[model samples]
Every structure is written in structure tokens, then in C-alpha cells.
Target: MDFHYHSLPDLFEQLGLPAEMPAVEHFIERHHPLPAAMLLADASFWSPSQASFLREEVLGDADWAEVVDDLNSRLHH
Candidate 1:
């Protein structure tokens, strides 16, 4: 399979969110510091579809995994 590099903005766009850097940063700032015990895919701010995409991509280690993981880290900080 061919591999494609996905950035944070790409992930956001795939999730149907605002994909601009400023919007992404604002989103992180608004929802950040996620509880240590909370799963990123279980975060309340995500729609069910968005959450499912995150969960599946990470679990499957798909093309979106790295960028999804990056987003997970940012949200927890």
C-alpha cells in the first residue's frame, strides 16, 4: 500500500472541521487539558462520526494515525 503523509490540518479537514491553523489552534486551546483518564475519541466535543473516525484510524493504524495521534496529544495538553 502506498503511504500518504497527513498533517493535523488534513485530519481536521477529514473530520469536517475548520482546517486552518488558527482555527485548529483555537479549537485545541478551547478544549484542551483533557482528563488524563479520558480517551481522545471519547472526548465530548467530537461528534459521533468524528469520534468514530479518530478511534478507527488510530486502532487500525491507518494513513491518518500519525496525525490523529498528534491531535490526541495536543488536546491532552
Candidate 2:
């Protein structure tokens, strides 16, 4: 069997995540490409905010944690 991989940006596009954050673009440029095809294939779900946290925090600095936390709180509550 053969498998193909897609980057996080491509996966986000496919999954319909908002693509507005430039910081996220810069982040994706530096890190390893995500296993997007696999992530998408999984039936699990993510709230938009959760996905945003993964994108921003996973690739970004610790300072971004504050922003993500604030946003997460707003989203959940």
C-alpha cells in the first residue's frame, strides 16, 4: 500500500479552518509538515478554537499561550 502526506496548511484548507493568522503561516514554514491526511481521516472532531490552539501554540512561542488560553476560555464558556 502507498500513502501520501499533506501539510498542515493543506489540511486546514481541506477541513475549513479559518486561514487568517499570518503568524501561523510563519510557524508552518519552520516546523515539520503535519500528517494532515491522517488527521483528517480520523473521525475525531475539534472545536475551531481547539484547532486554532494547536496551530498557534504548537508552532508558536510560550507567550502565545496567554492568547490561546484567553481564546479557549472565551470559546468554552
| TM-score of every prediction relative to native | 0.96, 0.27
Highest lDDT model number: 1
Task: Give the local distance difference test score of model 2.
Answer: 0.44
Candidate 1 residue-wise lDDT, 32-66, digit = tens: 99998899999999999999999999999999988
Which segments of model 2 are wrong by more than 4 Å? 19-77
Q: Write model 2 residue lDDT over 1-77, tens digit each, in one string.
A: 33344444444454465455564455435332434343311213566655665566535644344444333333333
Superpose all Cα atoms of candidate 2 onto the true structure and report the RMSD in Å to 1 decimal.
14.3
Number of clashing residue pairs in every model?
0, 0
Model 1 RMSD in angstroms? 0.7
How far residue 65's Cα lies from its native spot in candidate 1, in Å, is 0.4
